[model samples]
Target: MKISEELKYTSEHEWAKIDGKAATVGITDYAQDQLGDVVFVELPEVGQMLKQKDEFGVVESVKSVSSLYAPLSGKVTAVNEKLKDNPSIINKDPYGEGWIIKLELPGLEEATHLLSADQYLKALGL
Candidate 1:
């Protein structure tokens, strides 16, 4: 499992990469590995306002379907269009090209409450 130190993680297995007041959110590498191969992704439309920890999307895998939660409240600026056609990219590069959405965060401090890479690893009993 690979967790970059620059990102914050939620107990729900979501990651948020902070950039100024904007944040890019996605499922972590550990999450995708556990979920198996992805087949479909249902994402929120651009301009949708979401609350912290809200269910904003869904990821469907060959084994099961899982909810993708938001780590912080914000208005979605964009959704990854590539996933609509190739959901497997999530399993290939979850933290990079596979990122789900970019949001203009409502509260920057919300990210401070999230876990660090080491904390996430410990939470998983790694």
Candidate 2:
């Protein structure tokens, strides 16, 4: 499982890469691995408001369908439309091209609640 040191993680297995007031969010590598081969992604529309821990979307894989949660409260600035046609990119590169959404954070301080890469690894007992 690849955990990004530059990103913050949630216990639910989402990751946030905060850049100023903007944050790019995605399911973690461990999450994709657990879900098996992704077949479809249901993403929230751009400009949608989301609260911390809210269900933002769903990822449907061969193994199961799982909810994708918001890692922080924010308005979605963008969605990864490419995933609609090729959802498997999430399994190929979850933290990069497979990022789900970009959010306009209400406050950067909300990131404090997120775990670091090491902390996430420890949480998974990896």
The number of the candidate with the highest lDDT is: 2
Model 1 over residues 1-126: C-alpha lDDT tens digits?
Answer: 788999999989999999999999999999999999999999999999999988999999999999989999999999999999999999999999999999998777888899999999999999
Model 1 lowest lDDT segment of ten? 105-114
> Candidate 2 — which pairs collide?
none
> Model 2 RMSD to the real structure?
0.6
- Clashes per candidate, residues 3 or more apart or on different chains: 0, 0
- State the local distance difference test value for candidate 2: 0.95
Count clashing pairs, candidate 1.
0
Off by over 4 Å in 1: none
> What does candidate 2's lDDT look like per residue over 46-108, in tens digits?
989999999999999997999999999999999999999999999999999999999999897
Candidate no. 2 TM-score: 0.98
Question: Model 2, poorest ten-residue lDDT window?
Answer: 105-114
